[model samples]
Target: MGESVAGRLFSVLDAFEDGGPAALRLTDIAARTGLPAPTALRLVRELVAWGGLERGADGRYRLGLRLRMLGAAAPCPRGLLDAALPELRALAARTGGHADLAVRTAPSADGILCLVSGDRLPPHATAYGKVLLAVPPAVLPRHTRHTVGSPGVLARQLAGIRTAGLAVCAEEFRLGEVSVAAPVRGPAGTLAALGVTVPTGVPLDRVTAAVRAAAARVRPPEPPPYPSP
Candidate 1:
């Protein structure tokens, strides 16, 4: 390519975009982008000065507010969140539990993507976060002893979600907490997830079925894509 420096700088930014730490040290950025030490240091300094990244007190770098400001102005489907919010709220209200509509992010290695917290938020110890599967579990320091950490365990849970159209966690992710999640579809014909969380001892299957029905009610409007001619 023409300008290796520019490519490297963009790569550094891309590293952050792909779930790099909120703050990355010179070594951290180097490791994330596979850049040599000297190059990482120079690019990070430039990015920090340019307001694309910031060096924090601990000497780690993070995405700066300027990037976030610019990102927010980008266009996205307006109905994306609108279509999910009402049903999320209703689920929360009926279950007396937290509800979420989550989208999987393209960047992270995590099995799931993100959750839109609707009603009450589940305790950090619960699997609502796991069901949503946004950031890789490693990204967030372990918050609870009950958290299901292994990739194998999480894979199994996601399998269950695919088969049953929902996932349930009973005090496995948190103490005295339970969460159930169902998949939701979008206008673009993609599936997101809806979750409800409550204290342990609630009947999780009932909540799961209710959410599954709610997901069925909100059909995605996009026509299926035609195969190649």
Candidate 2:
């Protein structure tokens, strides 16, 4: 049987991946999608018309901003980022650091997906990742020289974080970077985390307080209970 149009379309989009080039030539897209040049051209033009893809000035194709808008509309348990943004902004303002919101997208995935971030930090080496990883040990791929590679040690560290109600990391993801994070709870459980990253020398006590306060301010909506039998 022939591949469905939808399947081919998805394959074309999936050809793009993180760390790959920002744009792909027509032949590159064709080869990546395993579609003949003619078919790929037809679909690429359609996608461009639909705003799912864009043709750059250089004549290469890239995923369009519309896709990002569409992806943001996808379901989240409790509108997590919307509820947390205010607090996140406050945290960044107070600490003058990178503030981020992260959530566990899947139990099997090794790391949390950042929903909103004020600055970039390696997920495995930051306080936000630690808070998200504390409950269930989804060991992350190492990204830095100081990244914790051992699950056993990470688990123990997470235990301490659970007790302290916050997580802190110093230069673990990148040299001279320090971060602190606290959990935002929902009716179901921990729905997301709030994090702030700063210079290594900044006093953590104030940052930790701000993070905790910000996390407390975000109240993820309660999930509707199951109907009683």
Candidate 3:
């Protein structure tokens, strides 16, 4: 059977994978999605008009910020962010660094999406990503030269995170940036990770303490009030 327009549209979007390039040329997108050049161009134009995709200054296409705004409204991350934002702000203030909340979008997905971030560092380079990666059903991706690339080495590191109830990354994602994170659990299980990023010069012990404390403060959302019939 022939593919539906909706399916083709999704294929265009899916060509841009998580942890891949931030932008792609028309040819790249067509090649990735296996669409003809004319068809890819038509769909890309439509997506751009609808704010689902963007055309960069260099004439390459990138995922639009609108998608991020929409993703933030997803029920799971939205609830976690609402519960954790206050503590996240306090953590950032205390540590003088970026604070973030991150969760796995799906059990089988390799990357954890940042629901909210107070800084500009890549997710894979931050403590928040490391904490989520430490948990089960997540596979780590090597994002930078500092990333822990070996499976055995990363396994040992994850074990330590589980034992200590916290995770730390020192310049693993970028030089001179250090991050610490702790898991935030809810009724279902491990729901998200709360993390802070600071310069490498900051005291690790203090940052670790602050991150752990902040994680502790995140409570699961209260159930919606029962509606009267």
Cα lDDT computed for each candidate against the true fold: 0.61, 0.75, 0.77
Each candidate structure's count of clashing pairs: 7, 0, 0
Show model 2 residue runs off by greater than 4 Å. Answer: 8-69, 75-78, 118-123, 134-141, 222-229
Residue 218 lDDT (model 2): 87
The regions of model 1 sitting more than 4 angstroms off are 1-9, 16-24, 34-78, 111-143, 186-190, 221-229
Tens-digit lDDT string for candidate 3 (40-107): 99999999999889898999997776776677787767888999989988998988998888876445
Among all candidates shown, the one with the greatest lDDT: 3
Which portions of model 3 show Cα errors greater than 4 Å? 17-28, 55-61, 118-124, 134-145, 222-229
Local lDDT at 141 for model 3:
51
> Candidate 2, 81: how far from true, in Å?
1.9
Q: Candidate 1 clashing pairs? A: 24-61, 104-113, 112-133, 113-133, 113-134, 125-173, 125-174
Residue-wise C-alpha lDDT for candidate 1, range 1-229, written one tens digit per residue = 3558888998898776564344567887889888889988888888888888877788777777566444433233224445666787888888888776555433352323233532222222344444455323543334466666565666666566556666677776567887776666555444566677688888766787778776666554454467999
TM-score of predicted model 1? 0.63
Better of 2 and 3 by TM-score: 3
Better of 2 and 3 by lDDT: 3
TM-score of every candidate relative to the true structure: 0.63, 0.66, 0.79
Candidate whose TM-score is highest: 3
Better-scoring candidate (lDDT), 1 or 2: 2
